[model samples]
Target chain A: MMTIERKPPLGKKVQLMATCLCDAFYDDAAVATVQVLEHLGLTVEFPQAQTCCGQPAFNAGDWAASRRVARHMVRTFKGELPVIVPSSSCAAMVFHGSLLAFEHEPDLPAVEQLARRTWELADFIVHGLGVTTWPGRFDAAIAFHRSCHTRGSNSAEAAATLMRSIPGVNLVEFGEAEQCCGFGGTFSVSFPHISEAMGRLKLQHLRAAQPQVLVGVDTSCLMHLSGLAEKEGQPVKHLHVVQVLRDALKNGGLL
Target chain B: MKFQPIDQFATTLAPEKRQSVYGGTKATHEKRTKLLAAQFAEPDHLRRLAGEIKQHAIENLDTLLPLAEERLKAGGAQVHWAVDAEAARRQVLAILQRRGATRLVKAKTMVSEEIELAPFLESHGIECLETDLGEFIIQIDHDHPSHIVRPIIHKNRREIAVSFEKNGLGAYNDEPEVITRRAREFMRKKYLAADVGMTGANFVVAESGRLVVVTNEGNSRFSLAATKCHIALVGIEKIVPRDRDLALFLNLLARSATAQQLTVYTEFIQGPKAAGQPDGPEEMHVIFVDNGRTEVLASECREILRCIRCGACMNVCPVYRQVSGHAYRSVYPGPVGAVLSPLLAGEHFLDKADLPKASSLCGACNEVCPVNIPISDLLLRLRDKGKREGAPSPGLPPMGPWALLASQPLVWKAALFCGRMLDHVPGALIPVPAFHAWTGCRTLPKWRGGEFRKWLRVRKK
Candidate 1:
């Protein structure tokens, strides 16, 4: 279980909603999320009953399947402090899809409440706990690929702002930072040719940046890009924005 | 020789058959973008260059227009300024009358289509013939271009063969070369006998008053070279400051369009004919049309004026690939078209509202745009404009209430629970037309009768 730290030291405890992608593919992001919150002098709690965010189904045009998943998520984190999600994709599902998913359900009011409390990991850190500075540093050039769901769909200025705040980091700006990476969930699978083409184009841009690390809020994009990078033997490393920050905080400003 | 309804042409050829051919073209387009993206390894560099060029051009457009007109006039090309489409058509008709041009041969030009020039000319007794093979097919079929680069994208060879048979060319073969031969045979006569030649300028270099026409088939060369009198119609926004700017644009244009090192023919005509030139137009005129261009250029939508008409954005657009261009209901269809059509055509057209929503906001168009137009960003802005104008809703599902509910947690929870319960209902209850459009293609599931919180509570115990 995760414990949430109360903002202003008097607010209600917030719940840490470990995103399904982080929980399954990168448990380290979830663990680091907890560690970062705890380092900020707040209690962090994890609701183990959390499941997939229903994005896969929702994007596939399967509304009914998505609603079932959304209902299960709302029920699991109902009373736990405001739900703090580790993944932007999961956060988007809660913030963007929940109400629509349960518009006609019997417990629509309850579902709406759960959706409102959900905050993306960056939002929780920047807005919820108010942690402006961290005790970590990295001496490397970084290019941030702002995911579409985070930048366009959700207000994702926090992570980039946070990265800029870190010491010894040179953040390079690429053209059209808010564009999609073309890894549209099953889009990569359904339209593999176009998907690979788009991915290669993105990879070309990434290679041009020649960054030691490529940081972003969503791991799904990283996972897809990393696979291609590994195949091409590119030296660029993919890291979740939160993990980079958590590492800095854990190392007491040394990275 | 006249502009025809898009549906009439689309329906003549089976939509399913066209879908398969266009699907292949889309694949080629994607491959081309990837290859070009590789060549332009530093995407940011091109972005910076494109942005800088556009900013400079837009800022000095008034200065550039007159300078271009003067140079064109000195080169023996008469220049005419048009305030709107009607004015543009009138100017074109007047030029035809003064030149005594009864038969006209035309190269591919979107400006002519936008101003309905061919129909007006035909109505006034001039026989207009489209010289480019793709333009010829569309002209004969009386169809609007589906793709800017490939106007006949929605027509398969089999269907084209049928059109040819009706033109008295008797069924020869279903091969592309055979069809090209048939078009060539028909257009050759028109080109040879044409009283005036009309072509669209891809880029108008303000420094020298030169009009550049890029084509794969050399048809533009023939149309202009074979005529006694030549008239080039260009949008005011097509002007660039210098000759050097053409290098970057030409390099990116063909690579983005069809992945070629260069198009087959890049004709730069500074004036109608040089004093010593053996074969060229004796008389030349360039009609600069400012139909809604000044409005778009002066407003926040000015970024769209930078388009080079490479059709790179359309080629890679997924929605365009799925629905094809005819569904867009505009001469320009696809990502660029979505933003451009509504802005240029006016929001009064009911279908104009659908233009913005026709996209999934996928940003592919922005990626491949040689001029670096922020297509997706502009698309969203257009959508916001539509909503503000109370443009009739595209009948999309009532996402407004849902979007509001999703932004708030409490309402979201209640909505989710109710949605879960309704999932169990037998009959379809999708309230929004947009939502119904989605559900109509897929299935809905039944709720498990318990909220996610309830399940969590049980597990905690």
Candidate 2:
């Protein structure tokens, strides 16, 4: 993928927090996140010491475990560069969820610092850099799936605005776009039937839009929806919004 | 109460069946909420005032309750104080016994449903009738109310028509208007003939000693006016400081509940018939029920008492939209219920311990709440409290091992390497419990070039 020209006055480097989902399952999203950042004129660094965001443990009522992992994350990404996460759920874990994780830890100041610098990919692009329109064009119609975390953060509007700015992409809207896709980390396994049911409904709504692709800010939702859609032999393709935006920027020949 | 796992409760109704029954109500609720947002010029400011009023009233309940009681007594209405649900029930029975009342007409109130007053009264040989159309239908059909505000929300109009016809009304059509008319005609007779009218107040204004009741149907008016005696069963937390504060609450209640500027009827009952009003209850009784609410006030989740039972939280909740109310297996359901039920019931009530985990911690409930209760944060706190009390979630790997693996890079790398080595083999070939559970619905990604850390490490070198 080719990188676009940089507009000055924005921070130069961002440490990419490739979430456990990106690390283990959706590596393409991790690659696309880096490409997307570089294209936006930001130097991207991968901190190899990072693993999980401690969200799974935090949400599962294991504060000790969450604190242990969150402390490590704070230590690994302890720099001035903004920590950019492709997954809103993981980004939320860093920015918001980690507050609960490190409440009683001695490194609370460092954790607070990490949270202040942490930003979801869409939020960092649209708000941190004030960039809405990017060099991109995808002829395919795209429907967006919003994670519960995005709806809470500023990322909900950011993702939508960024997607709408793609010159040739058709931003298809659907009902229940903001409904949870039921991939609540451990919730998917703890309550598989309910999780799968919610995913099915989300997929059904996405299909109603009849878009060529379903894109979302979080890959966990896509993973859950895609898994359910695949099992039912439903013909639906999933892509991260970052991937869609990055692909179009590369295709625009703006290197 | 017996404890049941959430998945087991969820499986009670198949996902398809639950969706078919619940989907329409969820959509209608979403539309109503949108309309409410559009109509209100400053919803946030209105909510702030309403929340502050409730918080202040609750903080000074000792002063307010006595003032309310004194004013009610001065106005010729009897005010009875009950410390708990049993005492509250006994108070109602005593009133019925003294009046020698055999027939009862009741309107919609979650508090009444919370106390199970109808069944208790029925067992004591009083013929209790539900005057609200939804409640009436559920009563005849021998079913509990599913959704709090909309009691029979799980049933379609066709099912309701069948229930109405089979119970007593002959050969009713499925049209909602016709069913509603038939219910009104049947309930009007009960209202005119019943010895006692039982109602729930939306707000208890201390200065005026009034029980404010709001309803779309005129049944509450009929229940309070058509009978000889009226009894308003109210929770202690429903107090507002003065009659003037009602203007703010009324707007929030209707807008949050049904997206109306105000419900069709908002009646202020200030002591009996006011000394010769031709058409009002001759005797008025206000039973202030504590029912574990003081404990709720003293707990860390004191903000939960700020809930006015508007039910805006349930309407926006994705989990409630999916599973419906009965899945919680409690009088209260959805986000508010998840917080309130376990808190009210105390630690011995293990049945409701799992209720806190029912949500996805999605803040939709919080966003839509008129009183601004941080329901998602409360749920998280409850989950932590539950863990401290030694009730870990059933059927999941303990977090200790994963936390340790996550903190140490080498061990995490080793685990990733082993996962990659196993990934070349089909995912189904793995027999691990967590992996098997995950793969049941979604495919595990095959490890290609190890995890991102290893790939990034090699690139760095």
Candidate 3:
């Protein structure tokens, strides 16, 4: 019910930057991404030529390689339609990280163009599409994990708003909810113990909340948290908000 | 001591130490947040002012330092320049030896810590007593301060009680007030008996040549007052342009440091005690220590000088919250330290090179920095600096080949197809070290549904 403007109503046409993580790790969330936009009357175009946002290279301090990879993404998603990303981190990479990587490259303008149009899906749904509530029911206690990239794109509140839209969902706020889940792309691999320790602390807070479902806009965070939970045999379910909302819409407000 | 990899330190030693430090910092961090919210009428405006003041000061140190020196000399205080830690130590040692001052009372100064002054003084038979409560506890316990502002931030009440008892301060309970009183009583004698006092300046005003020291307790004021000769050791970067600029930094300092409207004491000493002054030191000497600061000022990481040493960045850092300050093994720790320790160490930067990689690059440090230092960007610059200087590689999966594979469209699809095929294999059976590290905490979500590229191709047809 928010009255934010969308000059080109995102529903008519859009391109999906189904991040490499979604393509290889959580493709169902990628499908949910397409379905959710289609449900709202948006023509979601998946640029098959898109591969990676080059976040790994960028964060690894390989600016030259990051620029090379980001150039491919920029070249592939060249149309005028808004670039919708399911992952906040990838979306942020396109918007902020890619610009920095491509700052001195000849394709700087194209990268800047992509950066300007990039939108994280939760933010796109809530603000770009201006739909706060949907006919979806999820009868479960839920908590949203705000990833580090959420800060860059300012999507934490929008993601929270999307979760609150589900009619029967019981949203519980927890401590350290805004802290990083230690999935800093290569950070987890480089410093596994510290990364695991961080994830454990997050799990401690999430367990205290005792949510039946843990929701997040980014799979990377949920992936880290769920792995830790599985190791400890905690039966909490982890779902991307897109998948949860998509299921609710498909099942007629009952998920 | 040789350099140990930070990740290795975190894995081996940080787990046990992090929780206690986290608990102590979290309490202070919460208190600081609340106090800043209540006190600052417009915190954002104050932050911008503080940032601009620091930026201007660092950019014009050549003119400002001479101006400050002339004013200080005019006001009857001697000012000395030290180009490095050795020179800074020699200057302080000469001052102490001239006064025959063997016993010294001191306040907490990260600059002094930077120079490793306490041990240096101790080796020269100068019994330097740390009068600040947190510094007192750590000094008596033979431990380096784990935090910049909160010196004993790694210690809990029970640990302090044990330390106080062990140091013969008397049988003490775990109550903080009781331990503080014992420390105060113990430090009072040192302050009175000490021949010279040593403290670090929070800021030095260029216009009036005033050395400002901000403290929660009145330790700094007492240390500066009771002694005959007071030596103020300050980093060259601690200069502010005018006397009135104190109004901007003082507010930002307290708010960012302990989240207070104002610390209990904000003392501005103008060239020691002048003629006809009732109290304060007879002679004041301000030792301006360069100590690689000029080099940092010339580098890409110069904005790091804008830091007021508030320690807010550490208070909010998730990595600092988990690993504590000791894990950094640098004079400074957390985000600021990560950028600073390397840039300041010069040729030996790789000694603490792992510091830059310590962060998750979450930007929490930048978000809370009062001076608006784009610290995360500086951190990335250090990472690039390290790579260029031939520091050890990250020892993780190489991202270069991945980038190459991601750029070509045909190879990208085949790679995606392979990734989808590999998704069916249980993560446990993958036998990849990178996967092993990742799966330790989180289960990999299996790839489900069709690859987006194929779906897009079909839709196009």
In model 1, the Cα lDDT at residue B105 comes to 90
What are the per-residue Cα lDDT tens digits for candidate 1 across A10-126?
Answer: 354567876645543566666677667767666766665556676655544445556666776776676737677777777776765555556557887776666667778786777
- The best-first sequence of candidates by TM-score reads 3, 2, 1
Best by lDDT: 3
Classified by CAPRI criteria, candidate 2 counts as acceptable
- lDDT of candidate 2 over B1-461, digit per residue (tens): 11127666776875554765467557656766677678777777777778888889999999999999998998999999888778888899999999999999998988888888888988999998988988888889899877788787788788888887898786969998899888878887888899999889999998888889999998988887778899999999999999899888888888788767789999888888875577788899999988889998997788898888877788777778778888878889889999999887865546577788887777788777778787877787777777778875774567889999899987877776676766577666665566666677776545643455555566669
After superposition, candidate 1 runs with Cα above 4 Å error: A1-255, B1-15, B347-350, B403-413, B427-437, B443-461
What is the CA-based DockQ of model 2?
Answer: 0.47
Model 1 chain B poorest 10 in a row by lDDT? B1-10
Candidate 2 similarity to native, TM-score:
0.92
For every model in order, the fraction of real contacts preserved is 0.01, 0.51, 0.63
Candidate 3 chain A vs. true chain A: TM-score? 0.93
lDDT of 1 by residue, B357-447 (tens): 5554566677677787877656655655565566554223333344344434566445545755455554455444433432322222224
Worst 10 residues of 3 chain B by lDDT: B1-10
